[model samples]
Target: MKILIPFYSTYGHVYKMAEAIAEGVEKVEGVNAELRRIEEAIPEETLKEIGAFEAQKDFAHIPECNLDDLKEADGIIIGTPTRFGNIAGQVQNFLDTTGSLWMEGALIGKVGSVFVSTASQHGGQETTIRNLHTTLLHHGMIIVGLPYSFAGQGTIDEISGGSPYGATTIAGSDGSRMPSENELEGARFQGEHVAKIVAKMTV
Candidate 1:
């Protein structure tokens, strides 16, 4: 089975979580995951101001995700940094172009999940995830989240960002903070769980 992880990141925090999710997907034998990014709509000047956009080269080679990638995946995971309590504009623009796919129900029955990052603790992480789920539901995709079986989802000891809605990270203002170990683990759990679901559905 194949899982597609399509994410949008400005300061690279979300990108790191995407890689963790892919790592989890690999833990499930026979399931492969690919990481792709939605095209950046941010102006060149604006990206330069974020700084990390140019410094992060780990995923520079990955192609921009398209509608076909969405159609072909047995499961899909989306990640994005929050923008005013919602998903990034670049990610939203990519989905906006998938009207034809929605018309044909190309994603129906496929599993979908979301992850997000924010600048502050209450920086709308939950609302951002919920907003994304609303779109996934419109595509008739089965929504999957990190259940409590992944202990990281319920952690309250160290400061972390994750819940039943999905995995999340706290990216400090000015893009200083990165995802904590627990948050990354949560992302991986979500990936493995989604792949497991796809495996069973296919069986």
Candidate 2:
């Protein structure tokens, strides 16, 4: 099974989260993850505070997955950095362009999940994950999330990453908190969980 992981990252934190999620998805036998980044029309700084030196280089100018990837995948997982209690402009813009896919029912019945990173503890990570869920629901995709059974649920220090809605990372104030080992494991568990569910449903 092929899983498409499409995301947009500003400060590289979200990108690392995506990578961890992919690692999880690949852990399941017979599944592969396709990692794609949303292309911004105009290049932007990787972090607003970091200035030019930290600007993210533009990827190919495409939004989400190419139609071909969406058509081919058995599942999809999206990631984005939080922006004022919502998804980043780049991710939102990319999702907006999936109208044709929606009309064609290209994404119907596919398993989907969302992940996000925030600069603070209350930076709207849950809200952003829910927003991503709304878009996936509109496309008739099946949304999957982290189960409480995973190791990190409810633990004090280990509770910072992954959520019942999906996966997430708390990047701390400087956007420099590398995802902890627990958080990384949680992300991978989410990916593997979704992929396993998709496999069963498809079979």
Top-scoring candidate (lDDT): 1
Q: Candidate 2's residue-wise lDDT over 37-152, tens digit each?
A: 87654445444445522535443343446667777889999889899989989888878888999999999999989988888878998999998899999999998989998968
lDDT of 1 by residue, 61-176 (tens): 88999999999999999999899999999899999999999999999999999999999888999999999999999999999988989887677788889988999999888778
The per-residue C-alpha lDDT of model 2 at residue 63 equals 43
Residue pairs clashing in model 2 are: none
The Cα local distance difference test for each model comes to 0.90, 0.81
TM-score of each: 0.96, 0.89
Give the 10-residue window scoring lowest on summed lDDT in candidate 2: 52-61
What does candidate 2 score on TM? Answer: 0.89
The alpha-carbon deviation from the true structure for residue 23 of candidate 1, after best TM-score superposition, in angstroms, is 0.5
Q: In model 1, which residue pairs have backbone atoms overlapping below 3 Å? A: none
The per-residue C-alpha lDDT of model 1 at residue 154 equals: 72
Distance from true location, Cα of 102 in model 2, Å: 0.8
